[model samples]
Target: MPSPRPFSRYEFLIAWRYLRARRAEGGVSTMTWISLIGIALGVAALIATLAVRAGFRAEFVDTILGANAHASVYLSATSFTNELTGEVYTQSGRIEDYTDMAARLAAVPGVIRTAPVVKGQVMATAGDRANVAEVFGVTPQDFARIPRIVDPETSVGEIDAFPDGIAIGSGIARELGVVIGDRIRLISPQGAQTAFGTTPRVNAYPVTYIFSAGRYDIDRTRIYMPLPEAQSYFNREDVADEVEVYVEDPENIAALTLPLMEAGGDRALIWTWQDSSGSFLRALDIEDDVMFVILSVLVLIATMNITSGLIMLVKNKGRDIGILRTMGLTEGAVMRVFFLCGAFTGVIGTLAGVALGVVFALNVDHVMSAVNMISGGGAWDPSVRGIYELPARLRGIDIARAVGLSLTLSFLVTIFPARRAARMNPVEALRYE
Candidate 1:
């Protein structure tokens, strides 16, 4: 007689035999196909959702970090500058290397570029329309370094065409009914005495460029101007609201923060995006947790189907389990056979789902656009929705998570069935009609 083969090799053969028998016994019936389809749909949904979430997170972060500085330096709260009315004085001991600071920051291992920013809140009015806006003064040269800050379609000459003029957000421009080259009035929050008691001090600044920051709050409220013009217009001599620093590695923020603060001396205070946008970051984390919990319901339901299918397989293959056991198969071998069947079911289901999901995620934009075209419209327009295209980003983290979760659930589904197969009584199983 030939030497007995290991169970691992025979497991596949046993699984195949059981599967063929299942096919013959109407195991792949409408109900079974429905279960498989359910699993596939669940997996596909999970993949697509995660991909879109990742894309949104990435796009928002990139846009924010690109336009805004990675880290910031501002005078302490009480030490805030009121340079417009000449009420604030610049200290001789202020950050000395304003330009050099940017160069040196760029030289740091992870640092990208450091740029100057001036901030103030003021009312922007044009004709009969008036709205409050936040002014962000930036150097044109430095602003160019931040991608997407300038519209790609707009030429460089068009951007700096008018010296001493400022860039306004698209929404703000719309609100004020102004376009590029239109003169807009800015009223500083600092009050001025008038017949109607004290009112905000106001000035007029011309708009040089129109921009869409892609963030509703920023786009609606933020404005940008040349650093020199801002400094002179605000009457701020040798003072800035903050210095924005960009870095290559966001994770090394804390490590660089200490050194940067030390280098900034006494007058400057450093804050990372994490600190500056703490609430937003926290909200993102909460959103992630909520999404995971909600999406995981699909996975859990699919796992239930896997469990049911395995249980049914065990019941139907009781005779096979007995025959295999009688033919000198170990209890572990018998168990492994059922385990393979269940695992294969899960693997096939998951793989199919992943493939479908990849296709869906990649083409979600086209699919959504087609659907939108067919349906006519929604309550909110695309611009109001924050993005025109449905975005999806496939990340290794998402893939690993999906694979790990699906495999773990699949293995779990087989546990009970495997145990039942292992404990099968040969005599009773064979006697069953």
Candidate 2:
């Protein structure tokens, strides 16, 4: 018949026309709105889940670092003798090169400070209350450098201020019903050995100052005193359990581990924050993977709506397809027109979901508060949940993954409907009209 006008640029316009007509149809019921909401909810949940997980990881790590050493150089097996003593005292272990090794580690880039700390586990008793605590012996001047240990507001003198002073955990202090300057008896496992066997001996080290660390385990378990005091009690000098090293950059921790070990040689085993917090970090990673996989199915289910919408559009546009084919439009072009229509729905739904998800993730704390208020519940305690506040870690990688998955599902939904439209018989389709 007459020559048909070119339809390349007209395909987008045609796709929109068909989509709008379908939207206007009487049968386009709850299914349509359900699809949109599903996609929106799925995307929002994914974003919020990841942000919370990241926040918990960061806070937990900070708590651990605050409580423990950033890194430590432990003496594998080393001990030394007192040269000034006329009588000889030999250690079963090798002599630890603390000064030389601490100096070498302190020189490393990102290394902020290094100090020698002596530690031992002893049972401290006051009346009926006896609790086991880690006795940390440190130099007063050097201990002041520790952030949590030295508070200018509370602490007046250096760590050495209390020659026989010990800082106990808050829980421990409460358990014994004692405060600063209370006398506590220290019972060490290393007691006097007689010809018969080991006899229990108790040394009473007056608790000069009791510092509360807040952690029940640590506060109750950790007792700090001067290094000299610990050395005299333990009956050993010129040696320690390990030297703690603090770094400015926690990210490049692995870089310092090997070098520190090399400087200290095989006699010392170097440990980093990662090593100390390995189990916790591993749990966080697994949590992210498990939640992503579980929530992604919601987005996939929502994509089915895109498929159904295109199928309805295909049936409605059969007459148009027949006319276009008769006008010399190829099957591939016919398929592309329908594909473009379905993709528009996918694009709009995905974009809306992303916008909403971002807003929700950002305002999660407020939303949570509102939820609590509505339910008449008290404020959430992060300590119970292992977090102090809601943390949202929104990364480019996560956003990319979400968008990519949504787009891919959208593209796939178009295939069956597009093929059906492409394969329509012109004569058969036109006969119904």
Clashes of each: 0, 8
Global fold similarity of model 2 (TM-score): 0.75
Across 198-294, the per-residue lDDT of candidate 2 in tens digits comes to: 7665777666655533334555578887888777666557777678888877767888888888777666688888886787699889988999988
Q: Tell me, by lDDT, which candidate is best.
A: 2
List ranges where model 1 is wrong by over 4 Å: 1-3, 7-10, 20-24, 27-31, 77-110, 153-157, 162-164, 191-202, 327-330, 370-390
Screening candidate 2 with a backbone cut-off below 3 angstroms (N, C-alpha, C), the clashing residue pairs are 78-94, 79-93, 79-94, 79-95, 134-221, 140-159, 140-160, 169-219
After the best TM-score superposition of candidate 1, give how far the Cα of residue 78 lies from its true spot, in angstroms: 6.7
Predicted candidate 1 versus true structure: per-residue lDDT over 296-389, tens digit per residue: 7777778677667767777877887788778888788888887887777778778888888889999987787788878886633545545444
Structure candidate 1, residue pairs in collision: none
Candidate 2 contains a number of clashing pairs equal to 8
